[model samples]
Target: MKNLICLTMLFAICQRTVGQQVELPKATFAMHTGFLFGVWGNYEARLGQRTVFLTEAGFSFQSMAVFTNEGKEDVITPVLLVGPRRYFKSKISKKKSGSARITRGFLGAHIKFKPNSFFLDSDGLYGYANHLGVFPNIGMKKTMGERFVMELALGVGYAHYFAKQEGWPENIDRPTVDLRIRFGFNL
Candidate 1:
């Protein structure tokens, strides 16, 4: 009986040691889709303990198919974005909290490429130009689950364009707005 008790105690101690040594699962990658009258998707990769890399792509379409005079036209725009994100770590609960939960703020830049805006024949008459610009954005993200997160961000930047007319369309340079909602999952 004494030997049995000694063996049982040893087993309990071993179990406790093993339990205490268990490590928390590390976050990997996440993918999310959001809708704000339009659909957008984002993919994020964990870089380190406090940083992540993000890539985003999306498009917006008009419902009415109308052309200039009397036809239907479909206008679609595709965008690609890349940036580095700094994350804040929370002590409360890693599984229930997102990296943004602990983030104080972040700064990043993105470039947008737009095509199908210019016509060869209208080059000197009514011409459309492609735009290129850089923007710095700030935002926060909240982790609701181990694999789910929500984020909101806003940014203001400038865009440069080539104009065909010298006086018309006075506003050749304009300020742009960047508003976004993102969802992510661990890969």
Candidate 2:
């Protein structure tokens, strides 16, 4: 009977010493810009302890300043991006305090598509083209508060153009770069 009582007391002591685990967000929704030159809406879902699946969609209306030097073409199209993000465990994330700031670095691979991209050239003439690209990126994310998150990322890759322009050659391809700033909320 005395041993049973001692075991019960030991169990109680162990339970008191161990704290509850912090719950991480399973999903997030964000508004971002700079991927394809316009505001984008993003949804990210946690796929594992350190991995997330991300997607963004938006309409872009801007000049082809990054892709072409062919007389400043005005491009209007819908942009879609899909990728997976992997987070690295950090010292800040190991803290148990409620107000602890979590900063994590991430790596990602993305594929972007812009279909039926309509453009107007310097002479005020219209044409059609499709753009597809693959970029590998790296970034850092910080938790501002209980719900707010901010991130900055950069990607380098190549973009291929599929259309016959007035004077340019068919199937033109160029090197591409993407820079993004994101603001998000946990859900």
Candidate 3:
């Protein structure tokens, strides 16, 4: 009888431990490859079950062809961003604990601090330009297992750039677009 009781307790403890890891992620390591910001990455931390916050940093390489004497030049810049993301999960889902994974879709947003680019101006001089932009985004996330999730989102926002050198057109601002896809794992 004692052996039977011990086995039953062990079984119940095992079940609870197994159920603990199947739900919401507290944090994630994320990667970003986008049109506006080039290739960048970030870390996301969940503020709640359906909401998370993120920050990004990476590099972008740009090459420009010149009609003048300089044939081609490459400019590499560092990129950084910070923002929050909120997820809206689907209702119809696989259920084991009578609870579903809230990972089907999400509506999110971000503010990206643009990387600087170097360009050879008409005066035959290289100049630097940097921008900061923010946008609201929408995305979808899927969890393959206990730790991995994939996401994609689209956003549009306004941006402005600052140039360091004199006569470099310091105040340059425009509308920007963001299309991003992320593959991440919970931490």
| lDDT (0 to 1) per candidate | 0.49, 0.68, 0.59
lDDT of candidate 3 over 1-187, digit per residue (tens): 6534653454344334321222345767765454443556678788875557888788765554322254666655566788776555453355676644445555555678755554434454454556678766666777655566566777777777664433453466678777666655554
Candidate 1 has an lDDT of 0.49
Best by TM-score: 2
Off by over 4 Å in 2: 1-24, 33-37, 60-62, 65-70, 74-76, 91-100, 117-127, 165-168, 184-187
Compared to the true structure, candidate 2 yields what TM-score? 0.67
lDDT (10s digit) by residue, model 1, range 1-187: 6534653454344334321121223434556555444445666566754456777666544232222343344444455667665443232334333432322234445565544343222113222345455555667665554456676777677665544332335435677777766665555
lDDT score at residue 33, model 3, on the 0-100 scale: 53
Candidate number with greatest lDDT: 2
Cα misplacement distance, residue 73 of candidate 1 (Å): 10
TM-scores, each model vs. reference: 0.53, 0.67, 0.60
Candidate 3 stretches with Cα past 4 Å from truth are 1-23, 31-39, 61-76, 91-102, 115-127, 164-166, 184-187
In model 1, which residue pairs have backbone atoms overlapping below 3 Å?
A: 29-186, 29-187, 30-185, 31-185, 32-183, 98-143
CA-only RMSD, every prediction: 17.9, 14.1, 15.2
Assess the local accuracy of residue 123 in candidate 3 as a C-alpha lDDT between 0 and 100: 51
Clashes of each: 6, 0, 0
Ranking the candidates on TM-score from highest down gives 2, 3, 1
